[model samples]
Target chain A: MMTATRTKNTTTVELEGDRVVVIARTFRAPPRHVFDAWTKPELVARWWAPKSHGVTVKSIDADVEIGGRYRYVLSHGDNEFAFSGEYVEIDRPGRLVYTQVFEAFPDQPTTITVTFEEEDGLTRMVSREVYASAEARTAALESGMESGMRETMDQLDELVAELAAG
Target chain B: MVETFAALAEPNRFRIVELLRSGPRPVNTIGERLALRQPQVSKHLKVLKAAGLVEVEPRAQQRFYALRPEPLRRLDDWLDRYRQLWDERFDAMDEVLEELTQKEDEG
Candidate 1:
């Protein structure tokens, strides 16, 4: 069983199988409002970019329906990054499915599904990202492997020892 | 990096890496444990060695193959970036939702 790492605001992130990342979070807003925040381009532009990174959302084009497409461009100083996706499924205030591809790295595209469930007055949202492969997921990072290597090596050793003994 | 991914992508080679994680093992021992032929095991080891994911050490007449930590470490660090990216995005989304809820309550 995979363990989910929980963060503030009750957000949980877990690796599903080898190539899927599942993230779940509960918001105080209703399901409709929460769903709208994702489907509306203006709302997405307001919150999608990581604030501390100094990345600004340059433009957003969203058509929130089945077979519709969405595109977003972000800029960090002189460098511009673009990502686009096509909707596969759309169930208002409930579910959404899309294929997402980063323009810079078009080789591996990921499929993402978002589901919203209403509990009491709060909205529970779950997003699942399925990568083409484990290699594709790792390749997305592109650089830096200095820290955390020793700890991972130690864990691998322990896991191997346990497997061998069992 | 592409070489490492290509080398490790093979099922047999990946299993060998996992097996070597316990400790170094001679070619014949790895073959026996994995039910693979000696030649097959050697082929996989050659690929792994070429990719720098494994190294061989000669002791007397035998050569023991052990997993190299560097490539695996690089893979782990690469995956960490995706994890961090999602975390940051979700955090920002939470802030947005909170602000929107506040606006709705006021109006």
Candidate 2:
């Protein structure tokens, strides 16, 4: 039941019962638009990764229906990373459930549930990732994935700072 | 990093780290406070030491264990990426939604 809130953005990352990481964000867009962005491969390729990473999304094959499969590939400096998932549940513009596995760590599969709720024309998106175990989640953190992401984010921050200073 | 996570994954070891956070303590003292046996506390402390989360110093024939703080700092830095990733993605999504809105308006 540990929760961390970020003031810079309306995102809350919560660790519930040791194995789940729940992230929630509110978008100014309506629910339908938000859902479409999440489900459509072309739209997802635009925002799935931080632009500063310089990683090219090689391909996205998505079947947005129950029992359907999705695979996304990204390439960075001759290195390719792939993630694939199968949809378990789908409720258009409202909820989606899927099982995800990163090719780097195929043994550790995670289940993710995303829900979109509209309030006053704003859409609140909640995503929950449940790992096989607390150790599995910890292992994911130890995989250096966070450091790689942090490096890209730091680069983005430096660019922004330079522009602001100029 | 894997060792650190594996060490802290155990419930007893995790509790031991939480207990040491207030300050350092000897094995007997920690065992007494947590209602654990001396050997049990020592075993947990060994794992924590190997993980670089804690260090032991011999004081008057008693080894006092204290948290190193470096591993925890590394963990915090690692966790920050998760928050940052979502923030950046959502910012991009905002742009996409804005474009969609403009297109609808034009239509």
Compare the candidates by DockQ and give the number of the best one.
2
Instruction: List clashing residue pairs in candidate 2.
Output: none
Task: Indicate the docking level reached by candidate 1.
Answer: incorrect
For every candidate in turn, the CA RMSD to the true structure comes to: 10.2, 8.0
For candidate 1, what is the total of clashing residue pairs? 0
Ten contiguous residues minimizing lDDT sum, candidate 2 chain A: A157-166
Candidate 2, CAPRI quality class derived from DockQ? acceptable
User: What lDDT score goes with residue A16 in model 1?
Assistant: 54
RMSD of 1: 10.2
lDDT of each prediction vs. the true structure? Answer: 0.72, 0.74
Question: Where is model 1 chain B poorest over a 10-residue stretch in terms of lDDT?
Answer: B77-86
DockQ scores of the candidates: 0.22, 0.37
Q: Count the backbone clashes (under 3 Å) in each candidate.
A: 0, 0
True contacts kept of 1: 0.38
In candidate 2, stretches whose alpha carbon ends up further than 4 angstroms from where it belongs are A1-22, A30-32, A75-81, A103-108, A117-124, A131-166, B99-107
